[model samples]
Target: MRRRNLTLAALAAGGTLAMLPGAAAWSAEGSYPDKPLRLIVGFAPGGGADALTRIIAEGLSKQLGQQVIVENRPGADGVLAAQATSSAKPDGYTLLMGTNTAMVAAPTLRPTPPYDPFKAFTPISSAGQFSMFLVVPASLPAKSVNELLAMVAAKPGAYNSASSNSASELAMLQLLGERKVVNARYKGDMQAMTDLLGGQIHMMFTTGTLAPGFVKEGRIRALATLLPQRSALLPDVPTGGELGLGKLTITPWAGFFGPPGLPQAITDKLSQELQNTLKRPDVHAQLVQQGFEGYGMSPVKFAEFFRAQYEAFGATVRQHNVKFE
Candidate 1:
């Protein structure tokens, strides 16, 4: 299904497992999650995937009697985590926090992608959808996307941008394609963020899940959202279009996904619980604080969204001729 073979190393660091395969396993356990479940995320602790998964994991743990533990497997632009989820037992006990980075951009940017995202996993529910943000060091001379574009253009390779995931990579590809800047790579956004805070890298496009906290700390300032409309979280920040970079608009999303061949019973159960999780007041407030919102849709609806996103990202990939380095 992809140009490259997908191999996800099993980093089983103390988590519960679903019933082992066999027709009798279901009959042996009348209820789902007789044991705890593992929710896999593909980034380090401070990045978008890790942050969002932890929030959802807490809510799911309470809703289900067993704990839904989150495990980090950060690498290869989320291919590592997606591959782990794909190789997991499909009994619904193992799941992935499928983000645009992991599910869409990783595959789009690579030939022989680690896995065919749609084929390797079953869509559970849409977790969260959001616009991207152009984040720059507070010390950067530019305060808007237009100004940054000009700044980089004038200096050429004098400035460098950071990229950890495909969303940021996609943004950098477009920005660099036009203005030509250096891209300093990292295994995770948090790593890149480390440099951004220290002014080692000048700027990046980050998820709403990550940008606000740093911005509030004044370590970095979000110059603009990738969308044409203003963000609910950073109301004062203008959109790229508003800043005269209309070509920069891009909104990436994330969702819940389980290993392929997950039973309908388990899928429905988890989807319902995720919907409930999104509605919790505390969860909602925290998500809002980080610039994320609830996404409620049945597994069927989520599959539709998945297909649409798959098509959209494929177009972007082809248009830009993006590829793994």
Candidate 2:
């Protein structure tokens, strides 16, 4: 009886030992990025999203001690990248640099979007936020939001605002409808800016990264920003909210996301690395120079913030009756 008990005990002990390595392998959270990670940006190269992703990718590569490559898959107003990232394995190898337009506004704009915004992906962290500015050709006379409103009100449908068919355009349209201003629409902000410069379009609501350089060079005049407060880069410009157009507070934001069901260990590690990357002084300064505010948030906080933005954008879309083809 004693010999039989000893053999059974040995077998149980061996089984437990065999299970230990598998458990440790599953729970081994450190050195999170054991392989190359892909950071997907849903815009073409040389755009704001690409630029920011490149910066973050470099920093993340260093932090993870692995190659973090930025892959651009621009199409369908950022929907292609969203769908691809959403369907990818949730192993931390593939990550999406979530944007306001693709993740939040697209669902409301399209009758049937490719994926559900909230369920298709898990939030990592918000990298930054930036306010869109209402800018015109430097030669235009209107200087403030009120003045511009009056001008547009006086000549309804005479002025035009440009955007890239996402939240930017929808927000601007909602603001116009609220103020009862009629205007023309273009395919994208760049085209609108081209027309504005060529004396075809009158005005456009554009992102700071694209507007500041033109504003600085006297190519475009920044009339007002769509943020609650003035931008540090363009300190002289006032916010539309401050001018009693609080409804125009549309701040473009960017965040990190991965496929749903990512292990909490991998998610936590990625979030920590992202927060550290954003904390670098050079990164902060570069983002500020581009008229963006560094908006690093914890994963939980970012999820809440993203949800709020999604809901807000949806409301704006509904209010404006926006539809995309």
Among these predictions, the greatest TM-score belongs to 2
Instruction: Determine which window of 10 residues in candidate 2 has minimal summed lDDT.
Output: 22-31
Number of the top-ranking candidate, with lDDT as the measure: 2
TM-score of each: 0.71, 0.85
Whole-structure CA lDDT of model 1:
0.77
Model 1 lDDT, residue 138, Cα: 89
- Looking at model 1, the pairs that clash are 2-112, 3-112, 4-112
Error of 2 at 14 (Å): 11
Candidate 1: how large is its RMSD?
11.3
Writing each residue's lDDT as its tens digit, candidate 2 over 161-228 gives: 66665766766775676555445666666777788888776777787767878888888888887766
Q: Please report, in order, the local distance difference test score of every candidate based on alpha carbons.
A: 0.77, 0.79
Residue-wise C-alpha lDDT for candidate 1, range 176-248, written one tens digit per residue: 5667777877876778888889998898887676788888888899987875467787788887666566444
